[model samples]
Target chain A: MSKNQTVEQRYLPEIQRKEIDELKTTVKGASQKIIADNIARMKKADSHRPDTMKYFDDIANLFGRRQQEIEAEKQKGKKIIGYLCLFAPTELISAADAIPVRVNSGWYDTSKLGDRVVPVEVCPVIRSTIGAKMIELSPFLEQSDALISVLTCDGMTKLSEILSDQKTIWGMNVPRVKDSTQSLRFWSAEIKHMKTQIETFTGNKITRNSLKEAITTSHRATKAFRRLQELRKGNPVIMGQDAMLVNQAYSWDDKKRWTEKTEALCNELEKRVQQKDWVCSPDTPRVMLTGTPMFWPDSWKLPALVEEGNPKGIIVADEQCSGERILNDPIGVDEWSMDDMLNAISERYLMASTCPCFTSKDGNEDRINWLLNKVKEWNIQGVIYYVLRGCMLYAMEYNRVKKALDKINVPVYYLDTEYTREDVGQLKTRVEAFMELLNARIDF
Target chain B: MSTAKEFWRWHEYRHTMPNIAPVSDDIITAGVDVGSVGSKAAVMVNGQAYSWGITRTGSNSPESAKKALDLALKDTALSTRDLRYIVGTGYGRVNVPMANKAITEIACHARGANYIWGSSVRTVLDVGGQDIKAIKIDATGRVVSFLMNDKCAAGTGRGMEVFADLLQVPIEEIGAMSLKVEAEPEPVSCTCVAFAKTEAIGLLRKGWSKEKVLAAYTRAMAVRMANLINRVGLEPALVITGGQSKNVGIVSRIETLLGVKCLPTPNWRDGGLDPMVAGAFGAALLAKALYEKTQQI
Candidate 1:
C-alpha cells in the first residue's frame, strides 16, 4: 500500500468499516481534539466549581435540543415513545417505529436533587436520577410521549412508582427468570405486550407483516455493527477510537443520516483492510473497561490510560451505559423463517441483556465472568474498573469483582472517581503503575 | 555569644528543666478521634478542657493517637497515669487500643453540640473532610434519628477540595469566592464527580461568569446537604460542624435553603472538639455521677 492511498482504499471487514464511518459523523463540527481538551480541563478543575456549572449548562442545552428534535419528529407523523430500561422491549418498540432512550441518572449532580425526592443515604444513582427530575434536567419527563421502566434494581423499582405518577407512563413487572425456559417465556410476553402498548400509544395498528419487516431491518443493522466489532478485533488498528465514537453516534443520532454516513465509512474501511494498511503503533498492553462510564465529563481517564500509560489500551468491552454494553449483541435473526428470526432475536437479546445496575449478589460475579471470558478471548493483559464516586451498587461489589479477577491472575486497577478531571494527576499515576505491572508480568 | 544564639541556648535550657507537676488526679479524661484526613485528642481534667492536640492520620492511627495523646499530656503537664478513662470515636475508633470504649460520633456530636450551645438545639449537621452527616437531637442533646451521606466524597470537604484544585485556589478560598456572585450559575447535573467535570466545561463554553458558577455549585451542594437535614426533619437553631464548617458560603447557603440560622460554638476551630473527646467527656461526667451515687450508697 502506498502512503498516498486513503484509508478507504484498503480492504477492511464490512462491519469494521461501518463503525469507523459512524464515529466520524457522530458530533457535528466538534473535533476529537476539542472534545479531548474540554474533558482534560474538566478533569483538572475541582469537582465543585463555576467550571462544573458551565459544563452542566452546555450538556443541558445539547439535551434540550435533542429532546425538541425528537418531539418535532413525533409531530411530523413519526411514531416515537421513549423506554427507560435497556431491556424495555427495545426491538419491539423500535419495530413499531418508536425510539427507546436509556434513562441514565448519571448525568446530573444529586446533592439538591436528592434532597427534594430521596434520602441522602440512598444510592447516589437514585438520588441523582431523582435530582434530574427535581431540576427538570430529564427532557423525557416532559417530552417523552410515554415512558417504560423495568424493575431491575431497588433503585429502578422505586423509580417505577415515581415515573408512573407522571402522565403517559407504563410499568412492566419484569420477572426474574433463572431458568432458560422461564426466561424465553418472560421475554416473549414482554415483546408482545410492548408491541401492543406501542401500537396503542401511537393509535396506529402495527400489522404482523410490518412488524416482521421492521425486525429484519433492525437485525441487519445489529449484525453489521457486531461484524465491525469482529473486524476490529481481528485487526485492531483498522478501526480506532474515533471509529467507535462515530458508531455510537450512529446509534444515538438521526437514523437516516447516520445510516448513510455509516454505509460510506464502512466501504472506506473495507478498502483499508484489503490492502492490509493501518496505523501500527508499539503494542503496550490490552485492557477491558469495566463498570460504568464516568458520567461527569465522561471519564477523562480513558485517554490518560492509553496516552500517559502508553498501553495498547483496547477498551475491549465495558459494562457501562456509554460503551459496548449499550450496543453489543444485537437481536439475532435466523434465515429459515420470519418466526424463527423473531425467536432468535428475542432469545439472543435475553441471553445478552445485563445491566450494571441489576441487583443480585451474584450480578457482579456474572459481570466479572463475562468480562474475563472476553479478556481471555481478546488476549487482554489487564482490566480497569472505573466506577463513579457515589455509585453504591458498584462500590459494594468492587472488592468482590477484584477477588474474582485475582483468582484468574488478571491484575485489576480499581479507580474510584467523582468523574472530575482534577483527579487526573492521581489517576495518571495509577494507570501508569497498572500498565507497568502488566508489562512486568509479560516480561516475566 | 550573639543575642539570637544566647536566646536559643536559654530556650534549650528551659525545655530541659523539669517543672513541679500538680499533685491531683482531678478525674482527667481524654478522647481520641481517628479520622480519615486527620486525628485529634482532647483532654478534660476536672471538668475543664486543659489541653487538645491534632495530627495527620497516617497509615497507623493508633500511633497517631499515641502521638496526639502525648502532645496533649505534655501541654497539660499531666500523664496517662492521671487519666481516669479514655474514649475513642470516628472511623478508626476500633483501632484505639487504650480506649475504654468506642462511641459512635453521632452520639458524641450531639453531646458536644449540646455542651457548646445549650440543650435547645434540635438539629446538628456535621460536615467532615470525607463524609457529611445530619443528626436530630432532643432537648438533652441525645441523638433521636440520624442520617449519614454514605461512602461517596461528593458534597463533603473532599468535593470542595476537588473544586479548589480545579480553580487553582485553596479550599478555604472557595467559600469566599462563592460569596461574590450576584446570581447562581447553572447546577452540575451528574452525580459522579467525573461526569460533573464535563458538565463544568460545557458551562465554561457558554461564557458563564466564574463567580456565578461557583455560587451555583455551592448552592447545589447546599441543596444536597439540605436534603439530609430535611430527612431528620428541620428544627430550630441548627448547628453545623466539621472541617467544612469553615466554608461560610456552604454554611450560609444551607441556612438559606433550610430557612434556619446555623450556630457555631467557640470551640469550632478545635475540629469541632473531636467527637471522640466529647464522648470521653460525657463518659467522665457519667463517671462523676456514678461516683456521687456510690457515695450516697
Candidate 2:
C-alpha cells in the first residue's frame, strides 16, 4: 500500500465483502484462457488469459473489492470521478486533483438485472451499467463522487441523464465533426466547464504547475503503452490478448503505476521478441480488430480471434477503441494555464481521437487510411469489424471502412455481437471462414 | 433421451443416421461437415456425389467426423487414405484431423448450394441447428457478402427441434402438423428459443391445439428468418439450405412472407438434390478443385 493510503479505505464495502465471501463469483471465473493451439508452426504463448500476467487472478478477482479500494483512495484525500468514454480524457480529471476511474461493468450475469430499468434493445454495456449502478451491484456507484460522460451516442447521453440524479455528472459535448476549428473550440469550452465542476466538487484550485505535472505523468503512461503497441506489430511477441489486458488495466488503475508495470512488461516482451519467443507461428493469420470497446469480462472478441477453433493461431493487433486509443495521443502541455491546458486535452481527445462518432468525410477517410496502413504495416490479412449489439455509430461506419479495406482485397468479417456465450459457435464459424481466406492468401 | 427433456441441451438434437448408398464409380474425394446438430460426409467421384452419410455428432467432433466419413466410404469400400483430398467444414471444421483444408461452412454452403440450386441463385439462407446465415453469392458461387445472427436461438433449427419435442410431436411430423391447423394463432413473439418454449407451453395450457402451437412457433421462425434475410438484401434468386430447409412449416411461412416460393429445384437444371448435402457437396467440389490444382502442379 502507498504510505498515504489507509487500511479502512482499502477494505471491501460490507455488502460486497459478504457477497464475495458467500459466492466467490468474482474469484471463481478468474481465469479466461485463449489457447494458441498445438500447431507446430507458431511460437506464441500456449495460452493467454488471467494466468498469463503476474497477479492476474488477483487483479481479475479484485473486481468486487474495487469500490472499497477506490473509496480507500478517496480517504487518502483523492477525489474519485467515474468516466464512460475514451472521449473524456482522464488526464484532465487527474489534473483537477481527482482520480478518473472508467466505470465499465464486467459481470455478465450481474448486468442482467440492469435490463429491468432499461429497454431490452439498448446496448448491453449501457443496460449493464444502468443495472449495476441502479441496483447498487457495481462498486463504481459506491466509489464515484462524480461522473464525466462524453455524449458520443444516444445510449451514453441518456445514461448520463439517468445517472445524474444519483451523483454529479458533467457531460462533455463530443462533437460529431472532427478536425473542425469550431468543433475544437466547442469541445474546449466543455472541458472548461468540466474544470469548474472539478473545482467546485473537489474544492481545490487546479494550479498551472499541477496540471502540467499531470500531463507529464500522463505522457509517461502513453509512452509505455505506445511501446507495447510497437511490440504488437506484425508478429507479436506478446501472445493472445495479454496486450489487451495491459491496455484495459490502464482504464481502471492509477496511470503512473500502470505505466511502470506496462513498461516493465514491455522490457520482458522486448526480450521475448529478441529471443524469437512468440505465441503464434509466423504463419498465423494476422487480424486487425475494430468496433466495440472490450473491457474486463466484456471480453468475447479476443478469445474468439486467437483461440484454437480457428486451426492455425491468429495474431490480433491492438485496435482503435481499446488498444491504441488511450495511448496514442498525449496532451502537449507547454506553459499549462487552465485555458492552454484544457485546449491541449480537448485537442488530444476530440481532434486527435479516431472514434467513428467524430465522422467528417475527410476524418473518416483518414481513419480508413489509418486502418489500411495498419493492415499492411502489421501484416494483417483479415479485419474483424466487431460491433457491440445496439452500437449504431460503429455499425453505421462499417460500409465506409469496408469499402477502403476491400479496395486492397483485404478480407473483412463484420460481426454484430453481445456479451453472451450462446453465439460463440456462430462467431467461430465466421472467423474460421475468414481465417481460411486469410491463410489461403498467405501463399499468394 | 426423449427430445422433450433434452430440448434445453443443444447437442441432444444431435442426429447421426444415414440413408446412403454408393455410385460404384471413381468418386473418391471426400468432404466432411461436423456440425453442432449433425455430421455429414460426402464422397465425390467423376464430378458427381457418389456416396454420403449423415450421423449425429457426438461430444468429440473428430470422432463424429471420422464416423461419418467411414459410413460414407462404406459402400465404396474405401478409407480416408483412398480419398485424394478431403475438405472439412461447418462449426467443427477445425476439429477434423484428417482434412487437408478446413473451409468455413459459409463458403462451403455457397459453393454447395450453387451446384445444387444453380449459378443464378445469388442469395443463400442457411439455418443450421444453432446458427442462421444469409450469404450473398456472386455468379460463380463465391461468397460476396454474408450476415449471421449471433444471439439467442430463435430462428434456427434448434428452436424448431425444441418446439417439436415440447409438443411431443416427432420432428418429422411437426412441419405437416403445423400446416394442418385450422387457423394460425399469433406466432410466438419472442426472439429467444428458450422464451419461445415457455410461450409454447403457455399456449398449450391455454387449450391451443398441438397443431396450432406448432403453427405459431413455425410462423415466428419464418418472421425471424425473413428479418435476417432482408437485412442481407434478398436477391431474386433466393434459396434456403441446411437442416432447417426440410421444415415445410417454416419454409412455407417464409415463402408467404416473401410472397415467392423458394426454388423447387436447386437451380435452372431442374435436377433435385437434397438440401442437407449442399455444404458437403460444396466441400467435395472444393476438395476436387484443390486435388486438380495439386495434380497440375
lDDT of each: 0.58, 0.73
Tens-place lDDT per residue, model 2, B1-297, is 644344333222112224433344454688899888878888777557766777778999999999888877765556676788899998898899899998888989988889887888998998888788888887777887788876566678777777766776778667788999877788888858889888878888999899998888888888988988888888968889887787788788888998877886342112246677688888998898888888775
- Candidate 2 lDDT, tens digit per residue, A263-290? 8877877777888877768777777778
Q: What is the lDDT of residue A98 in candidate 1?
A: 70
TM-score of chain B of each: 0.80, 0.88
Q: How close is candidate 1 to the true structure, as a TM-score?
A: 0.50
Query: Residue B151 of model 1: what lDDT?
Result: 55
Candidate 1 lDDT, tens digit per residue, A1-444? 789544341211123446434532442123234444544443343232222223222333335455687778778877656555666656566666676555555443333345456555555556655555444455554556677777666766776666554435677666555335776787767766766788887776666665666665555665555655555554443323333344444333554444554555556556657766543432546666676543322333464444333333544444554556545666665563646655765676556755555444433345666777777776666777766655566677777777777788776766666523455533543455456446545641
Q: What DockQ does every candidate get? A: 0.02, 0.41
lDDT of model 1 at position A113? 45
